[model samples]
Structures are given as structure tokens and as C-alpha cells.
Target: MDINAYSARLHRDLYAAGQLGGEDALVLAEKMANALDPSIRLVLLDAMVEAAGEITEGLAPGAVEVRLAGREVQFAVTPPAVAEPIQPGTAAPAVQPPAATGSEESEADGGTARLSLRLPERLKGRVEEAAGAAGLSVNAWLVRSIAQVLEAPTVQPPPAAPSTPSPTVKIVTGQHITGWVR
Candidate 1:
């Protein structure tokens, strides 16, 4: 197995996801060089799977497409879904969602949901920048941020109300020879 090739692909995946950058690629390389903990290694493996989702996010949303190394590929991101409306007098038979393909299922087997978001090139670059500043892998950073958001409630502006003046308490302390209050 080509370790460099593996790293390169991981770099591309993270780069596309607005997570990792050129610099992060080097840090990950260094980590791989030293003895890595099994748990941490598992996390890196998940990050790689998540990176694949990131690459998909960068693709155009029409029919599936592939690009050659020396060619430019054009595409869009519209995922097709069957959402037939229920008839007025009759009910439609319940249908189950199809099982995920082997490759897609493999990611879930590894414990990461592998979600993705399509972002413009400039925006993706900014994500990489932010990830670099935080010294985290692109997938790691994005996943952490997403988990935090999911765990926290959305912020709402405070409601406006009738103006009620707050009560003020007065404090009197006299250690010196001077004490005055108005």
C-alpha cells in the first residue's frame, strides 16, 4: 500500500470539506510517523470516511459523473427523491428506503455518519484556514463543530418587554474617617 497516496487522498478529502489545508497535511504526516494510539487512529479512519463525503459535496448535483486526471468535470448537486403525494380517497402502500450500497454502508460500519455540505471554493478555503488555526484535521474540526451545534439549542434574541427598572441596593462601608451618601 502506498502511504503517500493514502495521505494525498485524505488531504484532498479534507481540503474539499473546508477542514484541512496544505499545512495540516504535514502535521497528519508527522502523526502517522510516530506511534499513534488505537483510539486516535480510529478517529482518523472516520475522518477519512467523512472526507469521501466531502468529495461528493464538491461534485455537481446531477447524474453521477467521473473526471479524468487531465480533464475538467462539470456537474450539479440535486439529489433525486421520490415524494409522491397521497391520493385524496386512497392511501399509498408504505415503501421502505433501500439499503445503502456497500461502499456507503462501510462508512456507517466505521461509526461516522459521513454527512457533507457543498460549499464554494473560496468558502472551502476559508474553512481550511479556520481548521488550520485550530490545529485540527478538517474532518475533525467540522465534525466537532457540527456535534457542538447539535448538542446546543439555537440562540434566540431576547424578547422585548415593558421597561421595568431594576432595584438597586446600597452598600455602606466605613473603615476610614469619611462616609457620604446622596
Candidate 2:
């Protein structure tokens, strides 16, 4: 298929899916114009339009059906059952992925700093006890502690003052030092 033709179709689909406005369509067109390959651009546009349709339609059900290329794409904006709407004078619950807490690095050998700290025996024992009470392993407890420390920045030490000269200095005569006394 001709990439230009496909790109135009994708743009139309996005508009019909109620996922993009005229300005957004123009922005997408600009991006497609700058793309390296027309086919890749068309594919990306299609994916984006489809994903946007899913998300927006899910959020605002029965809003409208978008018309594109003599066809209409119908979408509903129904939210998840557990997603409760915020009432007046109330804060909306934050929408974050529940499973995105720790180290979601792509590669196995991801560059993460590992610090080995040797605290006093008493402190170590306390940490162990706390970890046991919280039903977490030692490693987990250490990770939590490190995270807390990172969240609260360290108090930097005050800068040192320049050293001053001593009032007097005594010179002891020795075999190795006897050569030069200016």
C-alpha cells in the first residue's frame, strides 16, 4: 500500500475515533512529514490512533462516533469499576501503575549502585528485628532504608576553613636534614 495513502487513512481514523482534534491532526501530519520512512510513520500513526481511541473512549463512554473515510468508528468511555469519581471538596485518588515500584530496568546488567555499610552490632540487630517484624527480608529492609534516605536528602558538612601558620617552629638537627637550612 502507498504510505501516503495509509497515513491519510490513519489520520482520518484517528479523527473518526474521537481521539484527535484538528490541531492534533495537523501536528501528527507534521510528524509524519518528518518521518524517515512513510510506511513506519503510517504504522505508528495507526497504533497511536487505536490506543488513543481505546483510552479516551474508555474514559468518556457514549461521547461520539468519529467518522473517517466513509466509515464511523464507535467507542465508549467507560472507566474501570473500581475507579471512583471525586466529589466536590474531595481529592481524586492518584492514578499510578501499582506494579511500577522498584527497578524496572530493561537490561539484566543495569547500572545500579550497591553500597555496603557496616553499622554497629546493636544497629544491625535492630534493623534485623524490624525486618523480621515487618515480614521482609534483610535485603528488602535495606532497600527500603536506602529509599527513605534517598527521599530525604543528606545534610552536607560545612566547608573547611584555610589553615593558619604556627607561631614558631623548632628545627632538629639530624644527619639527613643537615644539608640545607636557608
Of the candidates shown, which would achieve the greatest lDDT relative to the real structure?
Answer: 2
lDDT of 2 by residue, 58-160 (tens): 3432122222342223332323225567899998777864221123221233633445689899998999798566444454456556666776878897998
User: Model 1: residues >4 Å from true position, as ranges?
Assistant: 1-110, 157-182
For residue 145, give model 1's deviation from the true position in Å: 1.0
Clashes of 2: 7
For 1-182, candidate 1 gives per-residue lDDT tens digits of 12344545655554454433466765665555443434444555555445545554443121222222332222322342446788899988788753223234335567445355898999899997885565444554565566566659888869987466445544557644332333
lDDT of 2 at 78: 27
Q: Which regions of candidate 2 fall more than 4 Å away from where they truly are?
A: 1-110, 153-182
Provide the overall lDDT of each model, using Cα atoms, as 2-decimal numbers. 0.49, 0.50
Residue 47 miss distance in model 1 (angstroms): 14
